[model samples]
Target: MNREPNAQLIAVMDEAQVSNKGLAKRLRDAAEQRGMNLGTSHVGVQRWRDGAGIKPETAALMAEVLSTKLNRRITPSDLGFFSQLTPATPPAPPSVGYPSTVSDALSALNGLAEEPPKGPDAGRLIVPDAELSSAVLSWMISRPDGVQADQPASQRVGMRDVHAIRAAAETFMQLDFKFGGGHGHKALRYYFRYEVLPLLNATFSEQVGTALFGAASEISQLLAWSAYDSGNHRLAHQYLTSTLRLSQVTDDRMFGARILSNLSHQANYLGNHAQAINLARAAIEGAKGKATPRAMSMYSAMEARALSNIGDHKGAGRAMNEAERYFERAESSSDPEWLSYFDSAELMGEFCHCFRDLKQRRESVQYAQRAVDDTDPRYVRTLGFCRMVLAQSQLLNGEVEAAVATAGLAVEGGESLQSSRFQRYVTDFQAEVSAYASNPAAAAFNEQVRDALARLDDE
Candidate 1:
């Protein structure tokens, strides 16, 4: 029978007289010393015992912490199976659950790391297709016709039409969230080009035109976002360029900031971490005092997320702190309807993800728990992501059993949501769990997650 180094872990635990809570407290304290705020809870430590290993870099940190506590050099091999682990394959569509939505699609695009393709591999991009460019131009030319030309130039277009388009775009956004971008983007693109653009072209007062442009710009950005989500990065990039042009024409600073945020997201997805950070900072600086509190908060959160990806832990934490403050400020300040998504919970969730990437396991778990606790039921996708982060944090802490349990919950929640990003999280967690294949519980969990992922392939 193959045995792990559990004996060493137990010896250290006993010598240190460390209860699970004690170990968690030590981990939290160590993290705090490194400028990470984390919570100490028994559940957090239980995850470590369950064989949920940390990221390799984080495992190194944990080794350092253990060495200090035990007064001996601790290697990841002493933690059992963690040092040898590798990242896992991404889950398939069927396992992801639910219909693809624009957000789900975008998440899929963002999750691609240029790593080896997994599952069916049909959706992965290998080479840019010229056909997508032609499709975009064709869609752009099919704008809706209007009788506005027959009317006096001043009376040609009306606010009611702008409102109607806004309403339609909002509906499409919702649909895109539920059904993948592939299902809703074409219709929205068609609507914007045909109906909305023609209206913009018709004669209208400066004030009315500005409002119309804002609505049109937002719809265009959403179209771009949807395209990005659907794995059509080239098309998405083209749409974003168009949206930026529209924002510039309108001189809408807020819209410009929003487009910049999308660009930051794209940069991050493409592994251009430095470019992503620069773009996010540009968005924040450009908005300056002009952005509503909610918008500013959202921008700061984006900055923190990008910083985390680039291994700027201190900067990322500071950005998260600033974002939290902005979120608090927004509570007393009424915000634009479009900016309502900015909230403390959302920011914390984003921060947790950053911590996960940085391998700050204790901090990741703390923030993830807070996010899960504070999130609304309707934000199932966010909640699922939070759970996945928590599970990963747990795994990193050396709690195989707890990691498996937490990962199971994450997988179940993600599978129910039909989010490719969430499924990728599950895949990563499975990869982490594979470190302890020698553990019966860990092996069982791995098999279960694998099976779940395989089912996704069928869909």
Candidate 2:
């Protein structure tokens, strides 16, 4: 029972006069446009044309390439990659458009909330890597959405609704820090769908409307962060990008810079250091003297991370020194509440990470231990993550026994959390311990982690 050839895809490719290699190149370019780096060679393209299934992320991009060529949307199903997997959520309407207008941005986000949740529950990283070159340029050039003095009433929006939105954002931030993003992401979706969506339609004075947008943007950023923690990178990117746009709409320079910083951080994690550096720099530029020093410091620290990874130690050092200087002059009370988490403990973690990348084990351990000691239990996922860095620093310093204990503490603290970042910490710790597998203590730690990871995977 041989299946039919991919005549649809082949015919489209023929009409577009696109070779396998050309399509692969276009897909990679599309990914880069969204600050992502995907590897799909011509060989993979040939396989796709031979009727082999492609990764869903790649499939979406391939469709985009064809869509651009043919001036028509082409979905994966049309290309013959359809599977029996249950639909996650109905796709947003095509007319929703980019995050250009307040109406466009809100409609897009609300539509996402309306989509049904997916099964196997593993979230996809962000997608539809549409060209944001325009988005970035506009952030630098356009006036922020000016004050709206009034809107027609679905219901008179009140101070109470604004308060509720702020409170929910704060609560969700706490939950994500303590329990990881996956802990209560559903609450976010529910809050957006049931609570915030209605308010967007509610009547409000200009001041109240501004406040509502600010509060809702905060919640949206939290949703983005949680989605990233849950290993749904694409969703995280989409949410973060839109939140950044929302920040612009609200004219909150500090918040928009912070959102860009998060996007920069994600790019670094995904091994796209060049893109990370570009995003961090863009944040600083977009802030245009409006960013608080603390916000500047956070963005600079992110740049330092990317610069160091890109083999620019001198540049990394200069940027890091700039961060420390700015942070010292920071008036925390004057800062937005969103920057609260970027305190001393978080800075120390960044310092430790910098030295670790440079292979300065002793210096790294000193700062890493400080981060672990300073980490509050309320920041459960961060505490677990810092412990892993300390453990690795100890391992690199030839303190194998202590490393095991530190790594064990991290495993205990983060085992139940669904954070890709914390999971990476565990993974890196195991790789270090593998060298000492012949040692009994190391073997025990490995077994402990094995069981913990099993539970995580099962979840």
Candidate 3:
């Protein structure tokens, strides 16, 4: 029967010499600056005064605004009993139910990519521990046992053992990309704990030990990225932390930068844009002259993506320009295999996405067209992303028919890709189509997308 504290809110209003309406206006202004539209009416203020508590996220925002306005840190707890109010909402059902395999979890995530945001309720989704344990066990069961050497004990262990470890790591990477992280992560972790760790612990020459360190670091990174792709952020962060330590053991600066880039991508997707930008910047700085040109370009591209999300259009464009220059320079030579996957077309496609997010329709359309024309058929996911941007641009330009057509193509292209991230881009585009739910053309397109996604889910 404890009442909510109205004292803190009242004190802040009195100190600022502002009425509730004035405070609401200021709060709205601050939220708008950060790309949120918060409409707090005078009635809402009165409700707070009457002991009705705000949602946790809204309360956090209020704390942020008060801290900025008062030039001091202000936590929700300062508001008294309201801070103690737990979320009334129940937790969301797990994406995959009990007894799910790694493959099942991945498929479920891919299916979820098509679901529209269920509002604040979406945050309730929890990944269960049983799902994680099952995935790891499946991966471990799938790996072949280590082969014993036939050669004499002296020269038997030189280059052959290293080659075998590297081959296993490469296979795991392919599995991760094709099947998603959940399927391969357990096996990768098993390899690290049983094989890689033992090899590192054994005495060897400096060169052999360095080679072993590199192999371990690569496996660690694959495991971390897989955990991330599977929506296990906390586990992913833990894996990445270990990967960083392994990379340091080998002085593998480039690999460390790559891991940081992936971390930045996770941060951006989680809506922590400021942290994303900072992590990306740290990655770029860490690479310096040690990383290859292609690596630098990739890092720059990551930074641009983070900046765009944070509403820094000018900085994003500048970073994109630099990324293009590096990509051009690398494309001229026989690019390394690792860097070969990212080309001018791919970078331009990503640039189109950045422009679309910033609402520069003309720029988005231009780059999307270029990307569409140049993309390879094997990269259907990239094509889908580019087409989605084009559809967005078309929608903004009032070309409803054209937007629907473009979105149709995007959906078709997305159906072929295994990437949940790519599927999400198309789903978001479909949601925009839903904005025109009354328009016959848009409604038709929306229905088509819904049907397509439903089929995908069934599969």
Q: Model 2, 1-459: lDDT tens per residue?
A: 444456557877896789989998998998787566778889987877776766555675676677568653344544655433212343331221237787777777886677733532232222223454555666667678864656666588877889988888888899899889888888798888788867877878878888888888888888878977876666677777677778777688878878878888887765556678888888878775898888888899999888865557688889899889989988988887778888889998898877766556788899899999998888999889788888877876878899999999989988778786687567556644654555688889988988998987898
Which pairs clash (backbone N, Cα, C closer than 3 Å) in model 3? none
* Highest TM-score against the true fold, candidate: 2
Residue 319 lDDT (model 3): 88
lDDT of 3 by residue, 306-373 (tens): 88755577899898988877776674364333355677788887787677656677887898889988
Candidate 1, residues 1-459, lDDT tens digits: the string is 332334445655675677977777776776676555557577755555554545543444555566566543344544543423211221221221211232332233233311213322212222222332232232233332222233345446668877887888778766655544555766776676567766654787666777777787677778777666655555565566456545554455666777778767776654456666866787788778777777888888888888886667789889988887877777535565566555677877888878876777789889888988898656656677777777777776877788788777766655544444455456555544544555688777767777776775666
lDDT accuracy of residue 264 in candidate 3: 73
Number of colliding residue pairs in each model: 28, 5, 0
Q: Candidate 3: deviation at residue 291, Å? A: 1.0
Please tell me which model should have the higher lDDT, number 2 or number 3. Answer: 2
Q: In candidate 3, where is summed lDDT lowest over 10 consecutive residues?
A: 116-125
Q: Give the per-residue Cα lDDT of candidate 1 at 34.
A: 57
